[model samples]
Structure formats: structure tokens, C-alpha cells
Target: MDIRLNQLTMQFEEMTAVDRMTTTINNGELVSLLGPSGCGKSTTLMLLSGLYKPTSGEIFFGDKNVTRLDAEKRKIGMVFQNYALYPHLSVLKNIMFPLRMQKVPKKEARERAIEMAALVRIDHLLKRKPAQLSGGQQQRVAIARALVKKPKLLLLDEPLSNLDARLRLEMREEIRRIQQEVGITAVFVTHDQEEALSISDRVMLMNAGSIQQDSTPQQMYKKPVNEFVASFLGNPPINLMTVERMEARQYKLENSAQMVLLPERLNHERVRVGVRPEDLYLTDKDSGLLSGKVLHIETIGRDTMIRLKIGNTSVRALVDPKHQLQTGDICTLGADRDNIHYFDCDTGERVNVEKEAQGDADTADVEEYA
Candidate 1:
């Protein structure tokens, strides 16, 4: 079931919830619509499910246009944030509800429901009421119900949000496995960056009613389309430093002595230098691009999170726990030439590395670090 949204726009009064969004969700691939709250991810999902008709544009489930289809007419199985199970009905009956409504014979519906329950690993819990099951179990029941009718497409709205940390981890794996086993085209909406990265085959990052970037989780993190995409996807966040080009291959932090030998050629005189926290390491002042005083430290597992104050700006880096450092101690940070990212100051677009004699600037001259 390949889903396509062709210039889909959903406007309500003065607000446009889904701006002319056009993209295709490939058959049997699970993609996640990821963004912050009010970014219109949920609204886009609604448009796809036929819950809201677009103000313009078209939607297709395979080659068939479903732009005017009613919600019930579209074969979309939706698993909501809340389980949305019946309190009085047992799991078996709840899972059979959809098939029953379609006038499926009682015997066939019962068998289908039982098979779905087994698929989601909840077959034994079929006799239990919704209130009798744990949060994870209830979620499994919801997933089973959605699949029992053999929906061509499945939409999960923050399916694991209500679970505990451990349960969330467990279900993330389960969802991916079950989705593969069912071989259905699936789309899930979530604000959790890590969750989207781990679970989906691809992620469509949304912002202000438009798709920002659509790519694999690895590419989205390694090579973000823009600064916002880079910042939004990281946990501690990528460190941003304002820099100005001094000359060829020479860039300096704005109004500071922190100089760097940028590996890429820049068309703009002013640009932003982005370096991930994990890419930096502690080094002597002579070999470092920037120097600062240690302001804060936190130990997360074996990795140590260190915040440094450089002039008026604060920079953060993650290091090994073996490096003993106290507050107020002077420190310097160094990054590999390939790890640094450069973006245009005004447009906020990445510098085109392919346009230049790449790596000519990376040949480290000792004086450049001074």
C-alpha cells in the first residue's frame, strides 16, 4: 500500500495546518512524521487518514485518488495515543469490533481476532478486560485490534508514550518487528527524536505546516538540511558558534581569538560553525581551536558531559570519564576537520563542499591553530 500526498493543504480559518505537502510513503515501509508540538505532524496524519479534507491538492492510496473519501471508507487503521479500548468488552471482542461492524461472520471474525492477538503476543490476554491489563498489554491490544481487520495502512499516534521508560524501549522494538511481520504501509506521529530515529525506516521532520526534511534517520542526523533540523534532532543539541571568514581556509569566532582552519570553501564571509558535542575532545591549548574555563560537569554512564565558558558564550563537550577536571579549570577543545559543519550566515544553508577543492584546507598548518 503506497500512500501519496499530492500538494495536500488543510486550512482552518486563518491557520494552515498542513501546507501543500507532497510526498510518497513507499509500500511496506514505516515512516515517522516527527516534529515538535503544533508543528502539524498530527494534522498531516489526519489529512492522510481522511479525517480532514484538504483545502486543496489530492491524496492517493496507490494509483487511486482518495481525496474525497470518508474516514470509514479509507482502509486506515489508527492506533491512538490513548488505547481507545472498550472498558466492558474483553480483549477478543474488542479486537473483533472492526470485523464485526463490516458484517464479518462471528466465526471468521473470532478466528481473525485470535490470530491478530497472537501476532502482537497478546493471545493469552484475550479473556481479560481493558482495566485488567497493564499499560504495555493494553497498547498491544490496541495494535491487535487495528490489525485484525487487515487494514492496508496503519497509523500509530505516539503508541508508546504512555508506557514507562523500560516499556517504551520494549515496545519500540516490538513495533518495528510486528510492522515487518505484518508487511503493511505504516506512518507514526511522534515528537520523540530518538524514538523516531530508532523505529522508522525514514523520518519526515515537520515544522510550521511544512515538511522540513525527509530522509533516513542516520542522514538526517549526520547531514541535516538546515540548522533547525540539526538542532531539533540531537539530544544535548549541536553546539553552534558564530564565525567570520578571515581569509582563505581561515575562519574566526566573531569578536574572539578562537580561529579554525575550515576544510570547506565558503561563499559567504560570515557563517555558523556547528560541531557535535561528541566530536570534540580535550587537548592542549596550542592544539585547540578554542579555549575556555570548565563551568559544569555531569556523568552520564561512561561519558562525561562538560560545559565550558568561552568569553561570553558557553560551549559544551562530551569526554571520557578518565579526564579529571574541576570547575574553574581551564580547558581547550579540538575537533576533526571533517566533523565541523559550516552554514551560510544569512540563508542558513550548508556550504557546498563539492564546489571547492575539498580537503586542501584540512592539511593542518601548526600556525593556523595559534
Candidate 2:
């Protein structure tokens, strides 16, 4: 089932939680509503589930308008962030509870419940209550309960937030697998960018009660629509340097300590250059694009993150763990020209320098093929 929200708005006395949001989610697609807290993601989910009627606008389940639908009538399976499970009921009974509520026969409900329990790999714990199960197991039970109903749409509201970091990773994969296996149209709401990026088929990034960008995870990260989208998607975040345009292709840092030649067209006298942490590579101090003193070092598994102080600005670079570096060590950093971003200083919007370069690359490839 495909879901469509047209100009969906939710007003709260003096404030608007969701502001003229319009988007389409394809059938059987696991779309994630990703943003910071109070960004209207959860509110949108509620509206879609028919818990709150939109102040204005229409909603459609496929081609049928469901704007006036009620929660109980939507036939939607919802999983909350808290994993709301009945502590008194055994896993089997808890999974069957939804079916029982619909007046399903006892034998049929039990059989379906067992099938769901096995689907989530929690069949062995059918006899255990919520209090006796581990956090991950309990979460699976909650998921099984939601799925046993076989609703056309599945809604998850930060369902993995309660789990540990490791468990969160495990459950995300489990959720993806289950969603695919069931072929149910799923909408997952999460404030964690990594969670959304890792699990969703596409991400609808929201902020300040508005949809910022709706695209695939790779596109969201590689080609963010604005400064906020660029800065919000990455783990360590993209490093931004304020630069004053010196000429058509030249720019100087805010501290006036270094000048750079971008070789890209620009229409403004001031711009901000965005470089992902991974794009900043270690190089000789005299030959690199940026140079600074290493202020901090963090080694996690295969990659090392180094925090460097460049003039008055702080920049972080992700480098190989094998390359040894310590605090107070002077290091030089260079960015991949193809990966660098140019944003309008006044508007905080990407300038598309990278895309232009990509176009030129494509043109070259086509010419060579010809």
C-alpha cells in the first residue's frame, strides 16, 4: 500500500507542528521519517495512523482518500518507541492478543501467533513474560504482535531507541528483514540519522516542522539539499569553513590565514566550503589544502578521527588507524576535490559545484565512448 500526505498541517494553538508537508511513499517501501526531536515526524506518523486528523490537507492510502479515517479503522499495525507489551501476558498470549481482540478463533489465533513468534525468532520464548525476556527479545515480541494482525501498513516510532547500541544494530537488521519478508509498506520514524540511513529504502528528512529533503539514503548523504541536511546526516558531521571570495575562483579563510583556489564558478563574494570528515586526507603540511595542529585523536576499530585546530576554526578528519598521530602534532589535510561542497554563505544552500564537476566527468566519459 502506498501512502500520500498532501499539504498535511498540524497546528497547536500558536505553533504549527507539521507545516504544509507533501510527499508520496511508494508501495512496500520502508520509508523513514528522520529528523531531530519535535520535528513533527512522530506527529506525521500519528496523523497517518489516523490518531490525529490533519488541520488541513488530504491523506490517501493508494487512491482512496482516508483523511477522515479513525485509528481503529485504518487497519494499520503500529509499534511504539517504548515497546508497549503486556508484562503479565506470556509472549504467545501477547502476540495473540491482537488477533483475539478481532474475535479470531482461539485455535487460529494461537497458530498465527506461533507463526509470528517464529518469524521474529522469539518462538522459544513464547512461554516467557515481558519481564523475563531480554530487551531485544521483548522488542521482537512487540514486533510480532504488531505483525500478527497482517495490516496493510506498518508504522514504527523510534522502536529501537530503548535497546542498547549493539542491540539497536541487531534489531535494525531484523526489522529490515521482516519488512522485506512480509512485503508490507512500512514507515519508520527515527531521530537517529544512522538508524534511518541504515534501515530505510528512502529517507524523508525533516526539520523545523518542514520536509527538508526526501531521497534515497545515498543521495541524502552525497547530495544534501541544504546546509542543515549536509551537516545533519553524517556521524562526525561535515567540516564547514567560512571563506570570503577573493576573486572568481579564489577564496580566503575567515582568519585570513590561508587562501584556496576552487576552480569552480561562484556568483557570490562569500561562501562556505563543506568537506566530510572522510574526505579530509592526511598529507604533507606544505602541500595540503588545509593545515593545523592535531588537538585530539580517537581510535575506533579500523578508522581514527583526528580533531585539528586550523587558525581559529576546528576541523575533524577521518584517517586510517594505522597512521599514528598524537595531540599537539602538526598535520596537513587535503580534501577530495570531487567530494567538496560549496554553499551560499547568506542562504546556507549548496552551490552545486560538485554536481557541475560530475557533469563534466560524465561528458568526458561519453565523448571517449563516442
Candidate 3:
């Protein structure tokens, strides 16, 4: 089902939990609500699932107004971090519970429960109780139960969080596959950026009761709307450097005596440059735009994370594991002009060099990363 939140707001005492949030989620699209704790992501999910009534505004499920609807009457299925399955009930019985609550015929509910169990690949474990299953197995059963009702919408609240790292990956793939096969409108809530990026059709990044950015995972990572979104979405995060324009096409570090020639297209007089760790290439000498001393190196199988100190600023760069580098080594970091991100230091807004030069600085800032 297509879901829309129109000017939604939720308040507790004097604090706003969700502030005038508005967004439309199309049918069959798996959208993720991603952010840190206390960011209102979970609150938004509860509102959509009709578990919490919004302090103001309206919610629509297709053409029906569901803002005041009861949780069970919303035709929404929910799976929580704990799985919430009845320990005494068999997998098949747990899957059939929702159907039975709606007064589905006994024989038909059983058939549908079996079908859903098979869909989530838990049919063979149908007779097992929640206590007899592994974390992943129990989660699969929960998914099966949610799907058994053929709900118009499915809400997942950090469903894979309880599993170990490997199981989290495995279940993420399973969830994506099941969502595709069933084609249900899904809203997945998670604080893990990697998990959301890996499985969501679109991601909604939230902060302090407001939506920060909403876009494809690739876009959100590459072209963040502001410093907060940029720094929050990436592993090792984006490298930030304070800079001042020395002259036309020339810029210098704000805290250092070092200066470098800038690309002709860049026109920001005073700004901060943000470069992804992957975008930086390390060199032996001061031949690049920035020079630093390597402070630490972390080897993680396929990739190496190198930490360097430039003046007083510390930056991390992701390099190949094969690169020979050690602590205390001096290195130069360079980024391709196309990969460099410019943000106004004072406003924390991205600087659009192309638009600034064309005298049209009012264009909407690009927020998604590629």
C-alpha cells in the first residue's frame, strides 16, 4: 500500500519527537528509517504502524485516512528486535495467530501459515517452538508470521539486530528476497547505515525529530545535504579540512602554512572540503594537496584504514591492504577534483561552485552520494 505522512508531528510534554515530518512511500518500496538513537526514527515507525497517535497531522494508506486508526485495524504487520514470538507456541501456530485473530477459517489459516513458513524457508521448523530455534531461525519465524496475514504494510524495527555479524548479513538477504517476492510496502527501522544501505530501496535519514535526507543509499552516501548527513552516513566517515582561498584558484589550510592550487571550477573563498576515505590516494612525498604523518594503520582483510594527522586535523584514508605503510611515515593525500566536496564552513551547507560561478547560487544542493 502507498503510505503518506502529511505534516506529521508528535510531541511529548514540551519536546517534539517528530516535527512536521512529511514523506510519501510508494507501494512495494522497501524504505528504511535510519538514524542514531533519539532521532525519532522509531517514533515515526510507530506512528505509521498506528501504534502511536500523531499529536498533529494526517496519515493515509492509499485513499483511506488512517491517522486515528487502531494499531490492529491498520492492516499492518510488525516485527520487533526481540522477534516477540510466543515461546510456548509452535512456529506454525505462531504464524497462524494473526490470521486466527482476524477470524480466518481454521483450515484456510493453516494453509496460509504453511505457505508463509515455506516462503521464509522455515517450513521444516514449523513444529519447533521459539525456544528450540536459533536467533536467525526465530527471526525467520517472526517474518513468516508477519507475512501470514498478508498485511498491506510490514514494519520491521531492527529485526536483524539480535543476530551475530554473519547472521545479520544472511538474514538481511533473506528479508530483501522475501520483500521482493511478496511485494509488500515495507518500512524498516535501523540505526546501522550499512544495513540500511545494503537492503533499502530508499533511505530516510533522520535527526532530532526531523528528516535530514531522503534518497537512494548511493546518493545519500555520496552527496549528503550537509555536514551532519555527510559525517553520519559513511564508514570511517568523510575527511573534513578547514580551508581559505589564498587567491583565484588557490587555497590554503586555515591552520597550516601549506597552500595548493584549486581547480578552476571551484570558487568558494572560505569553505570546508570533505573527501571520502576511498577518494584519497596516499603518496610518499608532499606532492599532493595535503601532507600528513601517518599515525595508525588498521588492516581488515581486504582493505586497510590509514589514519594521518595534518597540522592539528586528523583524517582517515581507506587504502588497499597491499599498500606498504607504517606509523610515523609522512604521506601526501590527493583527491580528484570531481570527488572533492565543498561546504560553507559557517552555514554547514554545500558550496555549489558551478552554480556560484554561473550566478545562480539558489539551486537546491545535491544531497545523495553515488
Candidate 4:
């Protein structure tokens, strides 16, 4: 089912949690509401699930207005950060609880519960109580319980936050698989950027109770609308450097004396350059963009994070673990033109000369083709 929020707003006594937010979620799409804590992601989920009435505006689930609908009437299957399983109920009973409440026959409910339990790969633990099961097992049971109802929309609020690192990874894949198999519209709330980017069909990045950017994971990561989206989406984050355009198509570090000539297209007087850690390569002093001393090195098996000081700025570069470099070692780092991102330092908006030129060329080509 497709979901649409039209001017949805939620306000506390003195503060607004959701500020006139509006967005559309396509049918069977796994959309994630991602932001920092208290960013209104959870509030938006609750509004969609019909747990809280919006202060104003409307919510439509596939053309049917559900803004004022009650939670049970909306047919939303919700799983929260806490498992919320009943202590006295066995896994089978917990899975069956929702069905039984809906007045489904005992035999039919048991059959559906069994089917869901097996779907989540927890059928063997049907008789185990919540206390008897591991964290991951309990989580699976919670999911099975939510799915057994076969709700039109599934709402997950940090469903994997309680699991350990290994379990979190395992459960993330499981959740993705199950969502795909069921073909249900789902809205997932998470503070973890990797989690949101990894599984979501599209991500809605929120900030200060407003939607900052809503797009596919790859678009949000690669072509972020602004620096906030860029810095928020990547691991180790994008390296942002303040630079000033110098004479002869050259740019100089604002704080440092190092100067390098860039492509003629990048003649902006002042700009912020963003480069991913992986985009930077360590090279010899003569071949590098700027020379710096390594301040720290963190080796994580397959990749190493090298922290280097360039003039007054600190930068991180992710290089192959095989490249042996130690602290206090002098290294030069450089990135290709395509890997470099130029942004307006004052506005934080991306500045793409190539894209603009390509767009103009495409328009001219279309006119000629016509």
C-alpha cells in the first residue's frame, strides 16, 4: 500500500515534534525514516500507525484517509525498539495473541502462527518463553508476531537496536528478506545510517522536525543535497576542506599555504571541497596534493583509517590495510577531479560545473534531435 502524508504536523505543549511534513511512500516500498534522536522520525511513524492524531493535515493509505483512524483499524503491524513480548506467553502464544484478539479461530490462529514462526526461522522455539530465548530469538518472535497479522503496512521502530553487533547484522538481512518476500509497505525508523542505507528502498533524512532530503540511498550518499546529508550518510564521514580560488585555475587551502591548480571549471572564489575517505590515496611527496604527517592510524583488518594533518586542517583517508604506514610518518594524499565535490562554503550546497554543462549539452542535443 502507498502512504502519503499531507502537511502532517505534531506539536507538544510548547514545541512541534513534526513540522508540517509531507512525503509519499510507494506501494511495497521499504522506506526508512532516518535522523538523530528526537528528530520526529518516531513521531511520524506513530502518526502513520494511527497511534497519535496529527495536529493538522491528513494521512492517506492508498487514497483512503486514515488520519483519524484508530490503531487497530489502520491494519498496521508495528514492532518497537523493545520486544514488548508478554513474559507469561510462550513464543507460540505471543505470535497467536494478535490473531486471537482479532477473534480468529483457535485452529486457524495456531496454523497462521506456525507459518509465521517458520517464516522467521524460529519455529523450533515456539514453546520457549521470552525469558528462555536469546535476544535475537526474542526479536524474531516479535517480528513473527507482527507479521502473522498480515497487516497492510509494517512499522518498525529501531527493531534491531537491542541485538548485539553480529546479531544486528544477521537480523538486518533477515528483515530485508522478509520485507521483500511479504511485499508489504514498510516504514522503518532508525538512527543508524548504515542500517537505513543498506536495506531501505528509499530514505527520508529528517532534521529538526523537517525532511531534509528524500531520495534513494545511493543518491543521498553520492549526490547529497547539502553538506548535512553528505556528512550524515557516510561512515568515517566525508572530508570537508575550506579552499579559496587562486590565480591560474589554482586553489589554495584557506588555512594552509599549499596551493594546487585544479580543473579550469572549478574557479569558484571560495568553496568547500568534500572528498570521501576512500577517494583519497596515499602517494609519494612529489605526487600528492598536500603533504601531511600522520597523526593516528586505526587498522581494521581489511581497511585502515589514516588521520593526517594538512596545514591547520585534519583529514582522514581510508587506505588498504596492506599499505603499512605508522604514526608520525609523512604522507601525501590526493583525489581525482571526479572524486572531488565542490560546495558553496556559505550555503553548503553542492556546486557541480560538469553536471550543469552536461545538462546544457543534453538540452541542446534534445532540441537538435527534435
The residue-by-residue lDDT of candidate 1 on 137-249, one tens digit each, is: 99999999988888889999889889999999999899889999999999999999999988888889999999988877776776677777877988688998887778887
Q: What is the lDDT of candidate 2?
A: 0.87
Q: In candidate 3, how many Å is residue 111 off?
A: 0.9
TM-score of each: 0.93, 0.92, 0.92, 0.90
Which candidate should be chosen as best, given TM-score against the real structure? 1
For candidate 4, give the lDDT.
0.87
* Candidate 4: 10-residue stretch with minimal lDDT: 358-367
Lowest-scoring 10 consecutive residues by lDDT in candidate 2?
360-369
Off by over 4 Å in 3: 264-266, 283-287, 321-323, 354-370
Give the least accurate 10-residue stretch of model 3, judged by summed lDDT. Answer: 361-370
Candidate 4's TM-score: 0.90
lDDT (C-alpha, whole model) for all candidates: 0.86, 0.87, 0.87, 0.87
Candidate 2: tens digits of C-alpha lDDT, residues 1-370? 7888999999988889999999999999999999999999999999999999999999999899999999888889999888899988999999999999999999999999999999999999999889998889988999999999999899999999999999999999999999999999999999999899888878899998899988777777777778999999897889998888788777788885777767565666888889999988998865578887899999866889999987789999899887778899988888777678878888888787533333211222221221
